[model samples]
Target: MNSASSIQESRDEIVPSGPLIRLSLWVGDRNLPFWVLSIGMIVMLLWAGAFKMTKPGAEGIIPLVSNSPLISWQFKLLGPYMGSNMIGATEWTAALLFIVGYARPKAGLIGALITTIMFFITSTMLVSTPDATIAWKGFRYMNNLGLFLFKDVISLGVSLYFISYYGRRVMLDEARTDS
Candidate 1:
């Protein structure tokens, strides 16, 4: 084969063209990532909310709850068990909103807002909780607690995405109705 033909063949190989490419394009074009994030958040929120309602789960989060300035009031007002239950109830409500948001953007926007607040509070635990970090070699490293709290940062971002996505969708929908 001539160099020109070989180059053309190389170019064709370099340019992705197949079922995988088509599938990726389709997934990207549609809002598959957003849906996946939403579904995953819903499942996690449901599971975590259920767990928080349990004795062990409520007991386990004592340190974080007691330490957090944002939510410590709950513990003071309701005590540990009841306070945890209240948080669990909030999570369940947010999860339910997320489920309904699939059909209603306004609902999803509210859910996302709630989730954002939740994550923002939890993420602050990295700084508020003493055991969250360990000083190693004169540098601070995240311990298990810190690492766990750190995941909330990513969750916060996801919630933010949900906020923007749903917010824009709601506005567009309203605009269309008005028009």
Candidate 2:
């Protein structure tokens, strides 16, 4: 090989792979991925649920909630202000249960189920919320409402993972006890 070509090859061999590759490998670890997902889920739930507890934050979602047929009865019976409070309370309760899951497997399993249901309901907003689509770059696309609701897909996936993992753990414990 020519001197320049040999030097380039040597440099390539000595240098490490790109960070993205390294990160992919690191996250590919079975346990690490779950822990990362769990931490991210916890942060998102805590932050979002905390906001739901506040007046401004709770009020902001009124239109969306009111529009949803599945939940609009809450708005009607409780009224906007009180209904918002109730929704906030529900979110906060689910988030707290998820936090407790870290220490208690049974509690964690219930939290995971609650979280899964919450995300599933929110994800349905893509259909229930009005004007969920918009024209973007001459192509029809999800509007902000759709975009906001669509992120529940990730949350749903994470919740399912928690359910499967914790559910299995709980079941195994039960079986061991029975035996």
Candidate 3:
């Protein structure tokens, strides 16, 4: 018991219990937010997957192009692959794995990497295409609507935050214990 207390004292000496501890936990350290965000992303990805599996219509994330008077030629290169459902399915697999919190350090990195790519690709499309011109104007997005966009933004942020958190010894211990 004395040794344990000594260890605790040593730990306290380094971390110093206070708002910093809580803040770290909330943002990227040993907090539940990281897991919550990960699982949330997974659930949303699944929801999107279900949407694709169910009501696949012209008004979909990708099919919305038909509603407009003119479709861009640039999107042709993307074709069906750029469709909302297709992209959701691709991301769902990764997000689901991440949501479960297995190999979180690695999972965090993967989620961040994929979300980063998604952010860049979507932003680029929104900027280059006339249809998505609204997104270029400012904080606003293009014609694309729904929680999917919101989820992507959150995932991108959480993934980045978690990656930093995963660096801490606390995360390493968690990963090691789980393994």
TM-score-sorted candidate list, best first: 1, 2, 3
State the displacement of the C-alpha of residue 81, model 1, in Å, after optimal TM-score superposition: 0.8
Clashes of each: 0, 0, 0
lDDT tens readout by residue for model 1, 56-98:
9999999998999998998999999998898899999999999
TM-score of 2: 0.77
RMSD of each: 8.3, 10.2, 7.3
Weakest 10 consecutive residues of candidate 1 by summed lDDT: 7-16
How high is the CA lDDT of each candidate model? 0.91, 0.79, 0.54
Query: Which candidate leads the pack in lDDT?
Result: 1
Error of 3 at 113 (Å): 1.7
Candidate 2: regions farther than 4 A off: 1-30, 136-138
Worst 10 residues of 2 by lDDT: 21-30
Model 1 TM-score is: 0.85
How high is each candidate's TM-score?
Answer: 0.85, 0.77, 0.53
Name the top TM-score candidate: 1
Q: Give lDDT tens digits, candidate 2, residues 1-179.
A: 66657977885686458998777655664578778887787778777877776788778888788888788898889887787777666666776776777777788888888889888878787888888888778997897778888899778998899999888778777878999
